[model samples]
Target chain A: MSDPLLKVDNLHVEFKTGSIITRAVNGVTFELNEQENIGIVGESGSGKSVTATSILQLIPSPPAKVANGAIYFKGKNLLKLSSKEMRKIRGNEISMIFQDPSTSLNPVFTVGNQLIETIRAHKKVSKKQAKQKAISLLDLVGIPAPDKRIDMYPHEFSGGMRQRVMIAIALACDPEVLIADEPTTALDVTVQAQILNLMKELQERLGMSIIMITHDLGVVWETCDKLLVMYAGRVVESASVKDLYQQPLHPYTWGLLDSQISEGQNSAEPLASIPGSPPDLSYEIKGCPFVERCPYAQDICYQETPQLNETIQGHAVACHFQTSEHQLERKEREYSDGDAT
Target chain B: MMETLLEVNGLKKHFPVSNPIPFKKSTQSVKAVDGVNFDVYQGETLGIVGESGCGKSTMARLVNQLIKPTDGSVIFKKQNLIDMPAEKLRQMRQKIQMVFQDPYASLDPRLKVGELIAEPLVIHQIGDRTSQKQRVEELLEIVGLNKRYADRYPHEFSGGQRQRINIARALTLNPELVICDEPVSALDVSVQAQVINLLNKLQQDFKLTYIFISHDLNVVRYMCDRIAVMYLGRIVEIGTFEEIYANPQHPYTKALFSAIPKESPFEEKERIILKGTVPSPLNPPSGCHFHERCPVAIDICKTKEPKMITKEKIHQTSCHLAD
Candidate 1:
């Protein structure tokens, strides 16, 4: 196979406040292929957003810093690039859409103005030509009556409409990679479906790879090809969506899957939830980050940290007892029990 | 047959908009909760599922009398709460409690966890200071929190733990009916599960009824016995969870259910994507509020309003073309 489009190798990010330092993204490594969609799933403060922001070198400095790692896109390490060189590639090669569209958009500017500005920033085009392309981009995102709607401010559009505007702006420069961080989270379910469908359709038409960061498994199930389950600061599991859902390896993945209130769940039974919250990122840890929450954590879990290993083809897991028969027996018992106290 | 704990009859809440012109009275009003009706059976959960601005929260507020309704009556335990005196209503509030969304915003920053939970007991004069403190400690243990942590502030706890404290505060009054408005939407899946399981267990131990409001269909399906699907400040469908899931009569309900992403990626769902956004409540569509976005809307749906039609023993829907 040809080389991957984007390679993120052993990335570590941290934030410092005074003398205390908080490790946000610790040794997260993954690759994105051409036209492939990847979903990074995790709870709040699990470092998924930090990983995505670090790709564009967007983490605010002074407090936020990239301690180590390399982000290679098209045989270029983004971290080593100068501010001038990076600015050219930031939005031209890789663009991002944030969770809340209402805030991401400039309240004072018209939708057309923002889209045209993004287009003009990356490409040498006349104002008239940029306006024409902006109108077409708005139309491509399924905004009704793009000619008239283009003149309206951000507050005039609905939540879903504003999200479409955000996507249009992100795609204005025709970036090869689009990073969407919870793009559909703020909208209604029906609206979320519309946005997801729009995103899928756009990916097919534009042939661009996407990095989708969200906490919803259902969203990933419908949209993503590969999945990365993050806990605390590290990736606990990574595999194709189908394989990971069918035969998950890590205990964190199992807990996440079981915690969901599925359609087939009995109302009388209690949901199996992870018992404890995520660990504090400011303190140094000697072992697994999820040791406190994992029901099957043993002495080794507290003493040593496990590395992400590909036990099967294209499926990686980070757990000390991932491939043991004893773990299999315990997993079976846990599944049979169904309820966690 | 289970007894009805609360009956809402033709409830309506409208906020009149001020006239843009000077010295002019405005005729326009936002009908936030227009003509909603439902019953909460004793020891049962009734879910209200709808999109934002669909009046789910407004209806919850109207039921608990946090906001007064423009019309209709709320009958709780054979007494009309709408017509009750303020003093009588204050006493009546002991039987009904509410847990709001946004755990961080719902709690006061200055108060300790124990004081926050015991505030209801202190207001109602239910127990002495010693007994209230003991009750707070007991509630902390019941909600699976360490008793010593009650002396700490709300900022010290995580989102799930703060939610547990909120649940404990709501239960302090021993309210027969608890109104949870989008309780788990803000939480992660793992923490959401913890809160949901806690609510379920508390209901069983206290023999409580719940009015669960949320936009998530899966959570609503798992938590509620019967559900009412709201649209544009009105209920489009109401039925048992099984009946609604198996055979949804309203086009809006069908579209809403189909819009939910499938549980597994391998399962393909025939999505019924609705055309436009929900209409503004200031002036809902002349007839059916959902006709503008309904896929199977007919001529009658635009000009003539549809009434609730009973399809099965308890399943009911309002749609011109349901038959």
Candidate 2:
């Protein structure tokens, strides 16, 4: 309702491999409001991580060029910022939690040292104060006996504990927005739930907006307030969590949901897998990005790119046939029936 | 009723932690897999679900005798795999194959896909060189990869395709039981479905038995006929898919099911939110391993271990409250 904390408009990212330029993020646009939890869901290589990395100017240059885009963070144009200014903003005002904590964390450094260094980099504080803050942050993220464990190296910690340490470092600066890329993918279900719940609690406590990038729709449903469905370097659907799940207008969204075998479902029933692999993003395309894999793709869908049309309350879907109320009704009927038992 | 393919009783694997303290001689052992027991029925997928460090992977490896069990017995086809000799174990390995989690890491980079698939057949002396090549092509086709792609190396294939190649290699020997440890966990959700479907197809076509080990409950719910929920290196609950999903007995099982993200547009359930990490395996709780984190823990749970009791027909759980 209020002005977005971060607004991305017409963002296009291209990766050049010799003669070929792959459009990784093509004309993508979205906004994250204050205290909002938004999920960017897509299969691997769909540019979901690339788009998130672009927000913080973390993308590698030469190979990856933000061909055209406007990234407005808190009314400031992040794309236009100088390297010095960007450095000040990165890890100070915005922090990220990467997928693999084992790799993200320096194996040589003690957890305490990393946390203290991270805190001291952004703020001018005494060593004692910074160490205290580090221990506190670790305690905040549910690490046990932060004081003793802080001195241990990353190898000493288990996978779940290492991820918690990553979270602690990410939240050390108390940033306005936290971008977590597949934060729980490497974790088990119990630990995944713990981390997700921890993130939710921290969000409430700090009142910081979150941009969670994951391919797991289950994570999105459990944690995110808004959902952004990506396909082939584009946003095919975006809506509030309730609106998106209750009545997913896009066929791609339908396929993603249907492919998920719910806990209560009959195990013997075959999962309705989407027919084909994700389209290759190497070449440019004119029509809908999802047309190749979309079961409901029509001739019109292949011929022209569809705009994000508001089909229902706060729900947007990029599909020509999304306008057909009859089809929508049928889909709604099927979704409810499938969900019901 | 189907015949039992593999029966594991009180399996244990303890890796001694070498503390770098002189004269202290601290023999802290990580109880990775401590007294896990289960039966894998013929032609059925027995899903082993657990959190990291809960010893699901170790169980899979122990069942295949990749690592000798520290204790207990693995009766594969009435043969004690734990005590089997090297020669006989090699023969047993042909009937029990393993598909690892990371396809890229599991596959040999230098070997061509065809050779990779044919290696298993050659080692087991299943067929001659010409026949092995033909069987490799057939295996490639079965796993949904084109026969032409067999000439390419592992690095050339995508993650999903590489996994398919791994599956094809696993099936080359026509092993009756396959230990697929987190096979699709490393893959994309969409690609995961593709791999899962291919696995299902292969199981049906060959009547293969699968020991599906993963941390994902949703995946286990989908692929397995029966599910075992493991915690602290022990099975807390075991039941048919229907019974477990419908009426999960153990508190741990209940929490696990509730943790799964539901797709329906309904109000979120109040997660059990267990407190504290899993206890240190070396110094696990005296009685119930889950007592420290169990919301419904009783006084007796702290003092005495609860043996797994049959709650219903073929449905079993190890909880003091259940008893």
Candidate 3:
């Protein structure tokens, strides 16, 4: 196939607190096809957000250090780009929408000002033109009364409105890639659906690749074409959305799927939560990061880190078992039988 | 069937919004909770699901008497909680507690973990100092925290650990009913499961009733025995989990269920996307609050308010079409 729109190879991110260094992203690698939407799903501190930020070179300095990694965007290595080049790429070629709009947005600036500034930063346009573009962007995001809302400050808008404003700003430059980090985690269910659908529609219209970082598998299934499961700063599983849900290879993926199952089905059976807390990143480990929490962990899993292995078509799982085909067939049989009953 | 632990009738909380301009009409009341009615049965979880600004949190606070209702009666075991004296209210508080959303802010930073848990027991004068200490330790153990960490301050604990401590403090009084307002929304997905499991175990062990309020339908579906869907200061649907999920009658209910992300690898279900944002509680729609955005809205839905009509046994919904 042609070169992916973005390619991440052997990426590692470390944070220094006092004298100790914590590896937040370790040897992570993934490829995003042009105009494809991929979701990186994991709980907080799982390095999902960090991985996205690393691609854009948004990691804060002093404490945060990208020790090793190669991030290629449209055949250009993002890591090797100078500060000036990176600035041009950010919000011009790539943009990100953070989790909480209440805090992510500047309180003092009007929504229009933020949108205009983002546009002017990338394009040499007149102030009036920028303002017009701002209004159109707001209108595109489905914000009603865009002309009136343009002058309203962030605090004036409600939580959901503020999120829409953030989206408008993110799309100001019509970037080729959009990194949405937990975009709807703070919104209610109905509002969440609205935002997700809006993103999907915008992706189709703009034909831009999107990296959706969220812990919710439900969100991933709804919007994402591919799924990457992260754990303790590592990509434990990566596969097509259909394959991951149909025949999950990693135990962590199984656990996540099981947890969500009890939500959809009103079963009296207790939810199957992962056994232990996520491993501490401050200390280095010899084996798999999820070994402590995995129910199917073996001595080999604890003794040596497993490489990402292709166990089924378009499915890669970093686990020793490699029984995805067997499990997939079994589940299909059970599902058909259950439906027949 | 479990006994009813708490019953709320016509509960309302109206906050007066003052005009910014001086000498202007001073205050206009916002009906945050407008005549909401529900019950908490012993050992059962009642989930209150709503959008933001739908007054779910306000209802939770009113049930705990954190904020007194403007008009209504809260009958806890047949005693009118609204009419109860302050001392009597204080006494009643021992049997009812609350767990707030933000673990970081809800906890006292200066106080040790042990003192945080002990404060409730001390306030109610449940036992002697030594026994209270022992109880605090026991509570920690029950919530899956090591008793040895009780001396540590709130800042030292992880988000999940702090929430576990919050749950422990809420359970210190052995309350019959606990109101959890978005308790797990702030935690990670994996940690959310851990805290939810702890809550389920505690409910079973102590026969505690829970008024679980959340905007997340997934979490509510897993936790609640019965679910209530709320819109601008009103409950649009209330029924058993099975009844609502399997056979949702209200248009809003169907829209909500469709909004939830499907887990299976099947084709996507056509979502009934609501038209507009939730109406302002300050000035909600005249008739049915959801009529402004309801896809199946009729003329009567905009002109005449619908009453809570019973469809199936114990299933109640406020929709003109349901009639």
Candidate 4:
């Protein structure tokens, strides 16, 4: 097979203030193939966003740095590239949409102006040509009456419309990769569905690899072909969406799946929640980062750190346990016990 | 039959939109909680689900009398809270407590956890300082927090811990009805589940009735016994959890449910993508508020509003095409 579209190997990101250094992304490795959608699912402070930002070389120096990593895009190392070279690749190749659409957009400028600026920034085009392209992009993103609406400022649009505008800007330069960080988190469920569907349609039509960074597992199930479950700056589980959901290996993944209040869950049963919060990232850890919150944690769990190992074809897990049956048995017992309570 | 703890009757709150020219009486207003009515039973949770600006938060505020309504009556324990004097309402506030979203913003940074929790007790004059302090410690323990955390300030705690502090503060007065307005929306998924389980447990222990408001349908289903689906400041459907989930009659409710992300990638969900965003409340539709976007809307829907039609003993819906 040809090389993957983007490969992140042994990525580590850190932020330092004074003498304190917070390890945000620790040894995150994944591969995104052409036209394949990959989801990095994790809770807050899980470093999913940091990993995505570092791929585009957006992390600032001094306070924040990519301590180690090799991000290979088309067989070129993004980390080794200078700022000037990276700027050329930033919007022209890899574009990102942020969590909050309102703040990401410039309130003072019209949507057309911003899109045209991005188009002109990457390509050698006339202002009129860029404006026409911006209008077409807006139409492609499902914005109604792009010709008139494009002149309106960001505030004139609703949350969902503004998000579409953000997507239009990200796709302005026809980037090969689109990194969306919690794109639909701020919108309502209906609007979220709209945005997710739009992304799926755009990916298939444009044939570009998408890196979706979101906390919602349902979203991953809907849009992504593969997923990486991160906890405490490390991927606890990685597999195709079907394999991971059917038989998750890691304890953290079990906790996350159990905690979701699905249709089967009745009001009488207490939600099976992970007992404790994530560990602080500023300090150093000896063993597994999830040991503090793992329900089946044993002495070995706290004493030894588990590396990501492929247990099945294309399914990797970072845990001491090799079999998923053990995790399933434990999860069922916990659920039944919760029901009894 | 379950006893009604609180009743909301024809509640309406309209904020006047200021005219561009000064000193001109504004003719337009945003009908935030227009003609909303629901009842809270003695010990049950009633979930209100709606999108932002659909007035779920505004309705919560109106129920507690935090913001006065333009026209309506809030009957709490057979007494009208709207007409009650300030002193009497202050006395009545002990029975009705609220847990707000954004745990970080709801709490005061300068105050200790113990002092913050005890502030409700002190204001209500429920107990002496010594008893209040003891009650604060007990409440902290009840919410699954370390008793020693009482001395620390709000900034010291994580999001989940701070929310626990908020719950403790709300329970300090031993409220009969706790209105949680998107309590877990601000936290992470795992922490959100923890808070939800805590809320459920507290309800059983205290026999508390909760007016839970959230946009997350799954959380609403897991927490509430009865559900009310709201749209454009009005309830489109109200029914038992089983009824609402099993057979959603309202077009809006069905659309909302269909919009939820599928359980798995293998399950093919037919999503009903609404054509446009919710209409502006300032200039709401003339007839049925949802007619503009309703897929099954008819000719009469644009000229005439639909009243709440009782489908079953406990199930009601407001839609022209539901029948």
DockQ leader: 1
TM-score of chain B alone in model 4:
0.98
lDDT of 4 by residue, A132-210 (tens): 9999999999999999999999999999999999999999988899999999999999999999999999988998889
Model 3: per-residue Cα lDDT at residue A312: 73
lDDT of 4 by residue, B271-301 (tens): 8999899999999998999999989889999
Give the chain B TM-score for each candidate.
Answer: 0.98, 0.97, 0.97, 0.98
lDDT of 3 by residue, B1-323 (tens): 76888999999999988999987985778999999998878788999997888899999888878898899989998898887889999989889999999999999999999999999888877789899989989988888888887899999888888998999999988789999999998987666777787788788889888999987788888888899998889999999988999899899989998888876757667888887688777788899988888888889998998999999987999999997
Give per-residue CA lDDT, model 2, range A1-341, as digits (tens).
66789999989999999999999999889999899999999888888999999999999998999999899998999999999999888987889999998899998899999999999988999999999999999999999899999999999888788999999999999999999999998877777888998999999999999999998888888888999999889899999988888777788888888778765565455666666667678877869888877667779878999887777776778888876474443343122101000
Stretches > 4 Å off in candidate 3: A323-341, B23-25
Task: Give the clashing residue pairs of candidate 4, or none.
Answer: none
User: Which digits, one per residue and each the tens of the lDDT, describe model 1 over residues A69-92?
Assistant: 999999899999999999898888
Instruction: Tell me the tens digit of each residue's lDDT in model 3 across A1-341.
Output: 99998999999999999989999999899999989999999978989988998888888986899999899998999999899999999999899999998999999889899999999999999999999999999999999999999999998887888899999999999999999999998887888889989999998998999999998888888898999999989999999998888777777887777656444554255655665578789999779888876666679888999888777777888876675544421121101000000
Candidate 4 off by > 4 Å = A323-341
Residue pairs that clash (backbone atoms under 3 angstroms), model 3: none
TM-score of 1: 0.98
TM-score of chain A of 2: 0.94
- Work out the iRMS of candidate 3: 7.3
Q: Rank the candidates by lDDT, best first.
A: 1, 4, 2, 3
- The docking category that best describes candidate 2 is acceptable
TM-score of each: 0.98, 0.93, 0.94, 0.97
Per-model TM-score of chain A alone? 0.96, 0.94, 0.93, 0.95
Error of 2 at A18 (Å): 3.1
Q: Assess the local accuracy of residue A228 in candidate 2 as a C-alpha lDDT between 0 and 100.
A: 94
Q: What 10-residue stretch in candidate 2 chain A is worst by lDDT?
A: A332-341
